[model samples]
Target: MGVSPDTAQGLLDELFLISRALRRNLAQPEEGRLLPGGISVLVNLESAGPCRQVDLAAQIGISASAMSRHITELVADGYVLRNTDPDDGRAIRVEVSSTGHELLGRIRESRIQGLQEVMADWTQDDAERARHILHTLRSQLIARDSRNAAADHQKHSEERIDVQ
Candidate 1:
């Protein structure tokens, strides 16, 4: 039989708790130079190279205004560089600077240290399985998002036709 609604909700709650714990442990302090939100943007840029601001915002799952504010903070902190998108002059693109890359490395190290501490009692196999499970979950989520986006686009197109 398919999973029950209660079982699915329980799994979602567990995932949310895991996300909260990671953010609590790894997020930068308010008094610190970097905000956790900005750091996340920097990390994404560091790995993804330059990306259009709107596209980056969508990928990060934040509203455009929120991403703009995070990008402004990151720019002020010298952790990222903003430039005109060569392909689309009206659009802005962002990339992590050298300083940002260094900061990202430190952030990654800190996260690894935190995970190590939390998983100290777990065996190597447990850690490996957890990593694999997370990867699978991420892939599934991405696929679901793609499907939703396509459906939304189709609905909007039909609405426009009806309007006409």
Candidate 2:
């Protein structure tokens, strides 16, 4: 059954609240803690492996210049390594360094501990159900976004052809 407008709006509100809370909680800067964007870059690099900076920026929905600055800081901090792409000498590929992996592990553990404390009253089943629902919702949204992006690209291509 289709979700009612009220239900949809409620879901959106809850999602926004959750996002804001998480960001606020995580944004507390410590001596070793990364800024949110740097954390995102490290996480993506760790998950997706090495790729060009431009592609990484696109995947993370950031401007290329912003990505460059993040990468520069990460490299300077010894959290990430940048090397020339083997296939394209002019391009650079970034990969998480060993230090980055250690930092990510610590970050994950810290987040998990915080979550456990927050959900101390909840049962394991409740946590599992929340995880499953959130995962499903995220997957569906990503799929829809991919489809829309592809359609937009095709339309742009057709426009270029017509112009020519």
Candidate 3:
């Protein structure tokens, strides 16, 4: 009665690919200036302030080692600065450099311009509705994850009681 599982998956993958291609083509950023991953890290730091490597990695959905490597690259690029964490003397903190902020601002403006051009024909109401739907979808996903976690916890508790 509804869409088949395979068909649904195919549609989702196709849409993701199309969106990635559009972003790549639309954002004609300067060569060797900044990539999407670096920009993403910068934006997160800007919002969350200086963060530990592991914290940044988790927030960015990356592994701790991978985050360290990325942070190394960022530091080398002069876009990110590193310092000792005063609260955790053994750990390090990273913050976006002034250059990084400037680059992020430029990227944001460029992306906005590209999006505006792409949706030039769409009405403001349409944009607002799209934003609302996107927020709703995100919320729904968070709720689903929370429910799944609760279910898993219950199963684990049941197993422990049975063993006891």
- Model 2: which residue pairs collide? none
Ranking by lDDT: 2, 1, 3
lDDT agreement with native, every candidate: 0.84, 0.87, 0.80
Of models 2 and 3, which has the larger TM-score?
A: 2
Candidate 2 accuracy as lDDT = 0.87
Local lDDT at 63 for model 2 = 94
Candidate 1 ranges beyond 4 A from true positions: 28-36, 88-90
Better of 1 and 3 by lDDT: 1
Instruction: Estimate the TM-score for candidate 2.
Output: 0.89
Per-model root-mean-square deviation over C-alphas: 2.2, 2.0, 3.4
lDDT of 1 by residue, 36-103 (tens): 56767777777778998788888888999988888899888888899898998988889988888887
lDDT of 3 by residue, 90-137 (tens): 989999999878877887888788888989999999999988976896
Over 4 Å off, model 2:
26-33
Best by lDDT: 2
Q: Best TM-score goes to which candidate?
A: 2
Estimate the TM-score of every prediction. Answer: 0.87, 0.89, 0.78
